[model samples]
Target: LLADDGGHPAVRTGADRLTLTPVAELGLGLGEGGAALTVLPLIQSALLLASAAGPATVYTVDSQDVLADPDTIRA
Candidate 1:
């Protein structure tokens, strides 16, 4: 989103620590400067537990809506 929205991203763990990953530069910038872009994805659960200090304390849940009803999904 940094490429399209001009905002930063971050993550938080159960231990309450927050970490920021530096976004990779997209070759050149928005015509206002140099420019480029890229896509995004995921992270592993084990590493997330480690960041929380241990698995015993970490609880994770993921949810995705059915696309059959795009309007509901958007809502």
Candidate 2:
């Protein structure tokens, strides 16, 4: 699961106390362009997770309507 502590600097200290996997590049290396391309994969991953989780699961329950909607999520 991805968690952002709103970029708070203080959280960095506590972060060392917990195990956290760094997000993979997923072939998407750093860039100052292709904003849409970068976001599309992220959206796809979230949708895939939600779909596998099935309807009414925590994934569906927690996401906004559009996010959880199968019709709205592209593979």
Candidate 3:
């Protein structure tokens, strides 16, 4: 998964951090400029947890739908 803080200009991880730098030469197949990328830590965490458990399926719940009928989830 890719995530951006949308506020900070820096990308950081528990083990390492990277600062985006500009490409000196332009139009030299350099694609974009000063691109920022972030790899979500949750992916690694989920993989580790899933490996321990036999097998599992992941699902996303919509907030509005859940709010409309929270009791169904509880039951």
What is each predicted model's overall lDDT from 0 to 1? 0.35, 0.49, 0.41
TM-score of 1: 0.18
Q: Model 2, residue 42: displacement in angstroms?
A: 0.4
Worst 10 residues of 3 by lDDT: 23-32
The segments of candidate 2 whose C-alpha lies over 4 angstroms from its true place after superposition are: 1-33, 57-75
Query: Each model's TM-score, in the order given?
Result: 0.18, 0.32, 0.25
Return the clash pairs for model 3, or none. none
Report how far off residue 38 is in candidate 2 (Å): 0.8
In the predicted model 1, the residue pairs found to clash are 28-34, 28-35, 29-34, 29-35
Q: Please, what are the lDDT tens digits per residue for candidate 3 over residues 1-75?
A: 223333333422411344432322122332232222212345467678889997655556668868897644421
- Poorly placed runs, candidate 1 (over 4 Å): 4-22, 30-37, 41-56, 59-75
Query: If ranked by TM-score, best first, what sequence of candidates would result?
Result: 2, 3, 1
Residue lDDT tens for model 2, 1-75: 223322444543565457542233333333333334555687789899999988872332324756667455323
Task: Kindly give the number of clashing pairs for every candidate.
Answer: 4, 0, 0
* TM-score winner, 2 or 3: 2
